[model samples]
Structures are given as C-alpha cells and as structure tokens.
Target: MSLLFRRPTLTRLLLLKNIKQNQRSTICSKPPKEKIGPVQSTFALCVFAVTLLAPAGWIMHHIPEYRRQGQNTST
Candidate 1:
C-alpha cells in the first residue's frame, strides 16, 4: 500500500529519468536496392487480402449453421 501511494514527486523524477535515457530506433534510413514489380505487388496484396478475409469469410459462411445449432441446443 505504501509503495502504491508513494509521493508524486518521486514518480515524476523516475519518469523524467526514463524519458532522458530512452533511445529511438529507425527501421531503415536507405531505400530498397531493388523495386518491387507490379505483378509481385499485386500477388502480395491478394495474398494479404485472403489471409485477412478468409477467416471472416469462413465464419460468415457458417453463421446460419451456427444459429441452427444454437437453437436446437436451447430447445
């Protein structure tokens, strides 16, 4: 309880110390050596779309089945 209720000044000091010591990292400063082709970009986009939408599509497709099961179980 004492630790949880410690003075605000101490917390502020700790936060300031952390902020001063924090280091930022960049992913990359240079551009890619090779550019991605349009075909490869389109394929990548399609794969990404399928990855994201396949599960939702599966769930939506089976929603009626799920509802029927729920009704049968409740009765």
Candidate 2:
C-alpha cells in the first residue's frame, strides 16, 4: 500500500523534471530578430492611435444629435 502511493509520487517528480529540462532547452534556442523601420513604425503608431481614439471620436460626433432628440422629446 505504501509502495503504491510512493511510486506515483516518484513518477510525478520524474515527469516534472523532464518537463523543466525540455522548457529550458527550448528557451535557450534562439533566432535572429528584425527591426521595425520608420515607415512601419509610423504606420503602426497611426493604427494604434486610431484604435485608441476612434470610439471617442464617434461618441463626440453623435452627442449633439442625441441632445437634440432629447430636447424634442421633452417639449
């Protein structure tokens, strides 16, 4: 009974050790990297800025219409 429990624990430890070794080896392998040029960087920035600001721009554009409708309904 004791052997049954101990065997699983030892097997688990061995499996965990193998997983850690594989992870370390994979992480240590490398590849060269490319740099982003100015045009690419500018385009990326424009896309990022538009994504960040488009929602606010849409809401700002619609606020006056919403206010006009609210005024008409109250009157």
Candidate 3:
C-alpha cells in the first residue's frame, strides 16, 4: 500500500530533522568534570583502593608464574 511506503519515508524525515536539531543545541554540552574537593577525592581514592585490592592481590600471586615464563623464554 502507498501508506506503508510513505510512513517509513515520513518517519525517516522526522528522525533526520530531530538529529539535526539536536546537533545544533548547545544544551547537549557535557558536564564539566572537576575535583569535587579534597574530602570527596580522598573518599573516592579509598573506595578505589579497596576495589583494586583483590584484583591486585591476585596479580601479585601470579607474579612467580609470569616471571618463570619470562625467564624460560629468555634463556
């Protein structure tokens, strides 16, 4: 039917128009990322260190495996 074909074309046109409008809008600007303050920064660091501790420990435990492989390959 003509409607089936025409509806998709109309929808495509509307979508293109919306995309162009969005491209022109300055309101799409990203928020500025800045240091929240020393206290917040310290808290974030503490959380990060806690999160990384387990992963770091696992990597450390594998150090002998990695070093052994490297030594064998070099000799």
Candidate 4:
C-alpha cells in the first residue's frame, strides 16, 4: 500500500498546476454599458423570486397529500 501511494504522479501534479493557472478574476469596476431602469429591474427581481419559490411553494402546498399517501403505503 505504501509503495503504491508513495509519491504524487506526474499527471496529478500537472493537473494541480494547470488548475491554479485556469482560474479567472470576476472583479469588475466598470460602469454599466446599458443601465437598467427601475421597472425592468423590479420585473427581473420578481421573476427571479417566483422562479425560485414556486416549486417550494407547490411542495409545501401538497404536504398533507404526501403524508396521506405515505400512511396508505405503510398499511
């Protein structure tokens, strides 16, 4: 076991080295190319919120049905 795991292989070392070089910086300080108006921004935020919450709300709305099915299956 010790012999098999003794040293880092050449490919593994190269992979780690390449990974360090592949990262990109996400920092930005530039002003907007096209400014979004308040109405558009509000619409975008509302759509995003509904997209994230709708599925969870549907599941929460059906919890009683799920519980009834589980009880029926166990019996």
TM-score of each: 0.60, 0.61, 0.36, 0.59
Cα lDDT listed for each candidate: 0.90, 0.89, 0.88, 0.92
TM-score (C-alpha, index-matched) for candidate 1: 0.60
Better of 1 and 2 by TM-score: 2
Q: Can you give the lDDT of residue 74 in candidate 2?
A: 100
lDDT of 4 by residue, 1-75 (tens): 688878999998999888777754445678999999999999999999999999999999999999999999999
Error of 2 at 35 (Å): 2.5
Q: Find the 10 residues in a row with the least total lDDT in model 1.
A: 19-28
Best by TM-score: 2
lDDT of 1 by residue, 26-71 (tens): 3457889999999999999999999999999999999999999999
Q: Report the C-alpha lDDT of model 3 over 5-41, residue by residue, as the tens digit.
A: 6556788899999999988985657777874889999
Residue-pair clashes per candidate: 0, 0, 0, 0
Per TM-score, what order, best first?
2, 1, 4, 3
Query: lDDT: which is higher, 1 or 3?
Result: 1
Candidate 4 regions with alpha-carbon error over 4 angstroms: 1-29
Would you list the clashing residue pairs of candidate 2?
none
**Pick by TM-score: 3 or 4, better one:** 4
| Candidate 2 local lDDT, residue 33 | 83
Error of 3 at 15 (Å): 3.2
Q: Output the TM-score of candidate 4.
A: 0.59
